[model samples]
Target chain A: MRADGVLGMLDRWGRSALPGATLLFFVLLTLAPLRAPYLSGALPLLPALVVFQFSLATPERLPGPLLLIMGILLDLLLGGPGAPVGVSALGFVLIRAAVVNNRRYLVGVPFLFQWFGFCLLALGFVALVWFFTALWTWTAIDPLPALMQYAVVIVIYPLLAPLLARVRARDPLNVPDASRGTARPGETTS
Target chain B: MAIRDDFEVVASQVRTAVQRFALGLLVIAAFGAMLLGKADTVLVEHARVLALDLASPVLEAIARPVAAANRVIADLKEFASLREENARLREENVRLLAWQTAARRLENENERMRGLANFREGPEASFITARIVGDSVSAYVRGALLNVGRKAGVASGQAVVTGEGLAGRIAEVGENRARVLFVTDVNSRLPVVIERTRERAILAGDNSPQLRLTLLQSVAGVQRGDRIVTSGHGGSFPVGIPVGEVVETGEGSVRVRPFADFSRLEFVRVVDYGVTGLVGSGGPAAPAAPPAGVRVR
Candidate 1:
């Protein structure tokens, strides 16, 4: 009985850690040297997508600290010589804050509505990073690349959303609205 | 049951408060890190190098299959253009053969003059070929992470190049990985000379595809198609390494397009010319003496 209990505890812990692990995988994926010009530029958006999806779907699984760590890892990996560290971390934190603040409006919304919300959030995120980077570098950086990044993120969101939803559904502890300690009209604890 | 419900509500409220507090702290911490990094602190560089060393192996492992797939795609592309490419190469080879003869004649004359002047030769450059395992994800930064480092004798300030021309210079070196700050990075600055006019200038990257030629003494002599090569002023890079060519000569802002394609870099040779007067923050370790019988020009 004790062994079974320990196994169950381990399984629960693993399930809880899945979202963070997925984020980490996306972080590494972003850093992979794809060598294709457009794909290389578009890869950085993967982690942001994961952060947004998890923040809205399961904020508790991906807490602030995990996002902080993921952001730092990205900054370190992507921060070249004289590039400011923690800018990515800052971006990730702001993304989570924006999503969590509007979670009530976004959680049960239609997919198109959620995607529209993401477009605004992503634009804001890109602009924030661009502004902070320009301030840090003290130069008028070109805005075209940032805009391109935003476009790619917006285009990719709807396609990646269903995949993220599937991953969330497979989580053993993800009991719809039950673990959130609140149930909507349509969602009920099994 | 009423007491339990009240306790649960209080606990949830406390949790929410804690999360908000933690988020605020993380934002502040990130700002602190950015400031610390901008200050160019050694602590931050060391931490970055440590992170790079830890992550390089996994990145390298992941890059292999992608590289293979890329190669296959490249092969298909090449096959499609094989006829035109072959015709162009054949024409180019014939032209190069004539240039090769002239180059050989000039080499003989230069050698004779050097012997007559008893010119001292600099140490021959050694190369360490490294595979590019990763690249900067942020558009703000222009750099690449190479899969060679201190273990492979890749020190900071070595000139990284491709067969075409100078790509960039080594910025940070770790135990098993190193970062190359591309010539198009905002932080990169190199002294170069216009080949046609011999006018010197500072080649600066503004995080754009084309590098800006700043600090030029004579912009009047600059024109389109002027070749820019390193002047070897800072002792960080060797003399006469091809950097780029003047593509645009706008008013007060000249743009030079780099010869080495930063987007498609796969393998780069890190050249150690034994000159170690790197000019930047956290400069390379104390300059090693030129080996016996070898003198820096």
Candidate 2:
């Protein structure tokens, strides 16, 4: 019975493994207080890039609440009165909404167009951040920090794209190979 | 078959709508947490501690090799400049010796004065030095994480200083790690006095390189070269730690350039000193508890 249960759990894990792993990896990266600067304060939005990639192509895979939780974790690490978390979570939801709506235009597009689209998404992210910061401090501290973050994200996303693509490809491809000839009685097997 | 297809279509629609509804709820919850946190900081402080305790262990483990590599790189760089650094330090040592002699005379005078006044003795402050593991990711508020935590008896509001001068204070502590709120962070407000004129002012951080000195008694006498140190009005930092210098003083405005190089910080000593009059203060390290409803926000 225990073996059957373990096997069942494995099967469930198998079906959505790649997207799950990708999301988990990025969320942890977001939570981790890891800072490296191409320049001082030029932190790349690693989690944002990951969310943008999957939210368009596979919105079902990267759940909205999971993204919100990631933002909360970010808030906790970022050390504020939770304003960054709300702003970031709102940013994630808007990105998911935008990407989901524009999926048809976005899905099979050239890398350049997707990159341009990501620019728009990142702008929203940056703007939300600046807006909340201004509200909190009652004065806009500095725009350079936010701009640097934008510049670094744009520079880093292309490098991360191929890796994200590889992760996205593995699971869906594996489903067919691993589940070959194991047709369920009622389901039209893919 | 047609009926089954229709049912599947309805099921998928329902699933989509449910997911959308859940997303909306999460967004609302996120905003609520933010708003509530703004209203009450104690909850936010608790959350920060909990999150750090959970994350810092893993971060500490990960940061070990990276920190070691950073040390090696720094050592290599230092080695290349060994002769220049050695000579510079020797010269500075010669300069400080004269100041040290003067300082000893002042110390003796102050002790005699205190004895004449019958001053009550305060608890002696202790120091716990910890290596900074990494810079914080959040741009909202400036912070740096340390490897040693509550396991090392690090607590919030403990002054974190480097060999150079004052760095900041422990804002949040975890089990095996802590986050130092730098002197340049927006939330940092230190009660500081001008070293030359003895004029008192509040040194406030605006998330910039130069800290702002506000609430000044009179900016009229302040000049560019004046030194600044803590007035020790607040019960957090002890009296007379060298904080920074007056870099810019304008009409009704003054800015300080911190003596410590915050950007290049690698390690700092968390000093536990009695700040709050030692009146009804608990044991040595644990800071005096916030009064019934007056915890610093």
Candidate 3:
């Protein structure tokens, strides 16, 4: 293969592979030593890591059904009570699909919107898992603690979003050509 | 040309259908695994143990430094008030000595009563001290793993307590460590009787700091300030240990405030109930004999 072809293949592979690897990193982070048992902070939103990666790199690579499968796999790996990751990933895919075309929304929106979106998805995800687990285990777990954890995630997003941006590609919102010229408000045509 | 072009369009459509069908199968399998995992059969247990074992070293490496720093900070915090603390301790020591004298007299009277009642034997007990190595990973359960295990004379069903009162029981034991299910864990249920009133009830933890007292035959005699003690009816925990104080919630429900402080859990004494001899064969169980400096009487 030509050098560009080799580089292109590598780029394609990296785009496809990096998200899964990062999710695994988050898994390990949950497995990291802290006050809480089980890396719950890392586990619940793991599907977001996968979804965000796919949306940024290859927006339509994973079909809706495939995204559902990815979520299911994440759910099992996370070892929670139910399809939290599955349901959340599907939610992300739907959101991404809905927003990908609206250049104005994607580019015009502030990072805070993204952060809030993540927060809502996380809250919904934890609630789903807690509900199913409580039903199956025949035990009621208070949602208050999980909500407290979600609050922590929301607080940390500013730090995390910038870091993830550096590690991955530039914000698709920033690059009109990159995200199919969908740059939103306050962005230059360049 | 017409036939060939028709087949090409249909070929892609069929392939898409097959791919979608396979994806459906994958989702079902993954979801099935989650539901089926509830059984907690030997396979799941083994996987959890293996995962924990693999993950323990990493957790320990992180927890060790955090625990050490916490201890140092605690020491520094205590240093600021050491003079006042010492003064209080000295005064408390004198009071405790007087209390001890009375306690000894009561013990003698209790022994006399037991003899009068013709009780065949006293409770056989041995204990080993261990350190809390880690905490449970789930929010739904309150638990801790201790460093001592079957190799160190630690066994399942052993009562883990502090000097003050009942802590919990040894749920699962491994070669060198054991998992202790706290008295505050959701699954914990122990036979208990209110110390002041002798009202029997089940002490159960529902992932709360206070354990609920359920199935009480009568609340007439049980009060908010009543002391709760292990009934030892279940043959797990030894009888007469201070468990908690009864806290009466509204609507006839009550819970016990556990005596042990779980947040700063440092050391625990694991009691080995020599039940094999005391209940059955009538011989000294394990440890051969009690260690010196510790007198049963």
| Candidate 1 clash pair list | none
Q: Candidate 3 regions off by >4 Å?
A: A1-109, A159-190, B1-27, B72-94, B108-119, B276-297
Q: Which digits, one per residue and each the tens of the lDDT, describe model 1 over residues A86-173?
A: 8788888888898988876677778888898888888877887788778877788889887887888788888898898787765543
| Candidate that scores best on DockQ | 1
Clashing pairs in 3: A30-A39, A37-B137, A38-B137, A107-A184, A108-A184, A108-A185, A176-A181
Q: Score the docking of each candidate (DockQ).
A: 0.65, 0.39, 0.15
True contacts reproduced, candidate 3:
0.05
Model 1 lDDT tens row, B58-109: 8878889978977887788889999999999999999999999999999999
Give lDDT tens digits, candidate 3, residues A27-136.
43443223332233343454454455345334544555555545544333333222223444444445445444443444436777656656655566567666765766
Which regions of candidate 1 are displaced past 4 Å? A1-10, A172-190, B1-8, B276-297
The candidate that achieves the highest TM-score relative to the unseen native structure: 1
lDDT per residue for candidate 2 within B1-297, as digits (tens), equals 999999999998998798778867877887886687678877778887887777765666666665566567667878999999999999999999999999999999999999999998646776777777657744556778887776666678889888877888888777667888888888888988888888888988877778999998777889898889988786767788999988887888788999998656766888878553355456443443223322121
State the lDDT at B197 in candidate 2.
89
lDDT of each: 0.81, 0.72, 0.63
In order, the candidates keep a fraction of the true contacts of 0.75, 0.40, 0.05
Candidate that beats the other on lDDT, 1 or 2, i.e. the better one: 1
If candidate 2 were superposed on the true structure by all CA atoms, what would the RMSD be? 6.2
Please tell me which model should have the higher TM-score, number 2 or number 3: 2
The CAPRI class of candidate 3 is incorrect
- Give the poorly placed runs of model 2, Cα more than 4 Å off: A1-40, A81-85, A136-139, A173-190, B1-16, B72-94, B97-122, B149-151, B275-277, B281-297
